[model samples]
Target: MEISCHKIASGKASGPALVSKEPISFLGTVDPETGEVVDPKHQLFGKNVGGKVLIFPGGKGSTVGSYVIYQLKKRGVAPAAMINIRSEPIVAVGAIISEIPLVDGVSAELLDLEDGTLITVDADSRRVRTEEG
Candidate 1:
């Protein structure tokens, strides 16, 4: 299925899907080493984000969130693309600095996407396409 939203960057990628109904907090919530969500209460907790399309409601906590995101990128533990219901400044800054594909203003239905689905994000055109694995 194809859905259009505002894209933070334009790109296509095929990777395992990771969906989170909760917003993520970069501070102390993610493990940069393994790209795993460390927050036990988070829907994606203990899930590896590496090489996956990371989808969440949005970001929360700390202006330094962007720095953490960049660090993850530098460590090669960053998600291939990001989809959010809304874009937070921290996430926006990180996506820009880390050069990761990002799309926001997406519908909550994105949360229904199963893990391992192949999805493409076109940030330039604000589109997201999903196909069966």
Candidate 2:
């Protein structure tokens, strides 16, 4: 399926989709060390977001989410890209500062996208295409 949305950064990315249907609490959800989600109740709990396309509804908690993202990037555990159902300032700021590809306001077809699917996100054109592995 094809979903059209606004992309924050244009680039090619292929990896698993770490889907999070609920809002992620950036303050506690991410572990800076392993670049994995540490929040036990999070759908992506214990899952490594590094090199994955991290998808979610949006971010919650403190505004320092951007800092956390920067730290993750510095640690070399940042996601290849980010996809959100909607854009939140916290997440947007992080994406910009981290220079990670970000797309948002996409359809639920994004949720149907499996973890291991090879997907490309074009932030410049606001497009998301899924390819079979």
Instruction: Please report the candidate that would top lDDT against the real structure.
Output: 1
Worst 10 residues of 2 by lDDT: 7-16
Segments in model 2 whose C-alpha atoms lie over 4 Å from true places: none
Candidate 1 residue pairs in backbone clash? 9-123, 10-123
Q: Model 2: per-residue lDDT, tens digit, 17-85?
A: 777788876778998777988989888888898998888888888998888988888899999888988
TM-score of each: 0.94, 0.91
- Alpha-carbon deviation at 17 in model 1, angstroms: 1.3
The list of candidate 1 runs beyond 4 A from truth reads none
Look at candidate 1 and tell me the lDDT of residue 57.
89
Residue 98 CA displacement from its true place in model 1, Å? 0.2
Give candidate 2's TM-score: 0.91
